[model samples]
Each structure stands twice: as C-alpha cells, then as structure tokens.
Target: MTISNLQEVKSRITVFGQPMICRGCSHEVFIPYELYINVEKPGIGCLYAHDIAICQNCGEARHFSDPSDFDNEKGIFVWALRQYVC
Candidate 1:
C-alpha cells in the first residue's frame, strides 16, 4: 500500500470506546477496527474483511476471518490467554 492510502485508511478507522489490555504486555490500548479491502485485479469485485489487531506494547497481532467475532468477551479472553502462553 502506498503511504497516502495507508494514511487514509488509518484516518478512517474506528477505534473501540474501551481500550483492551494488551495480551502480551497487559498495557491498555485502543484496538483499531478497520475494513480491509482486497482487489486482486481490475474487474474482479473487491473482497473485504475486518480482521486485524495489533498490540501496541509488544507488537503482537491477531487476525480473524470475521471482524464481528473480535472483541467479544470469550474471544478476548481466549486471545489474551493465548498471548500469555505464547
């Protein structure tokens, strides 16, 4: 992605009201939510998904197939646990 495009995407992202604790470092930080658009080639419809989370403290990241599944209590807990173990 070009710098301009990345900047635009970053500006448009919606962050959660409540920050989540970093799974790797336990630091509280807002989890950014964004729609990722993928276009393999012209004429092909774009594929979109909301699926990325990066821990600001430790630089750990997690990806989900579906964005809607993220941030749910169970998912968050599991993610935190996994990070802790890893």
Candidate 2:
C-alpha cells in the first residue's frame, strides 16, 4: 500500500510484472512473492497458505501455497491438507 520506491512497486504474480485482480472482491492485488517477502512484518517469516495475498477491500485471500507442500511424496503441508480436506 505505502510504497516508497517506484522499483519496489511491481506486479503481484510470481514471475513478476504480472498483475491479477482478487477473485473474491475483484479488487486489484499484486502477487509479488518477492516484494511480499522483502516487505513482510519482522516476525512473519516465510509465506504460507494463511499468509497468501489478501484483498485490501474485502479481505479475500489469494492462495499462493506451494504445491509441493501438498505432495504425498513429502509430508508437511500435505499431511495438514489431508486432515483439513478429510
């Protein structure tokens, strides 16, 4: 929201320079995974599901979760997703 550097303001998508509107409220939101990391709150750490991009207007969240986290090939988030889905 309060961006100081022009270079800092970038597209929200992972690849960068790709803008997309929030599905919930149709409000414009950037998916800049990098910017999100650099500008994160001190204790936020790495981004997660609950930490996905959120709409400023309606609080709709854009899920940027890692699919690997859901792979049975590994545990972690997948185990959590199964518990959540089942």
Model 2, residue 61: displacement in angstroms? 1.0
Model 1 agreement with the true structure over 15-57: per-residue lDDT tens digits: 2323345567876432344466875786687876555556555
True lDDT of residue 62, candidate 2 = 65
TM-score for all models, in order of appearance: 0.36, 0.32
Error of 2 at 38 (Å): 23
**Predicted candidate 2 versus true structure: per-residue lDDT over 1-86, tens digit per residue:** 11211122323433122344688777664432223443467776865323355555676766543222345565544321110000
- lDDT (C-alpha) at residue 27 in model 1: 62
Look at candidate 1 and tell me the lDDT of residue 25.
80
Judge candidate 1 against the unseen true structure and give its global Cα lDDT, from 0 to 1: 0.40
> What C-alpha lDDT values do all the predictions have?
0.40, 0.39
- Which regions of candidate 1 are displaced past 4 Å? 1-19, 31-33, 37-43, 63-86
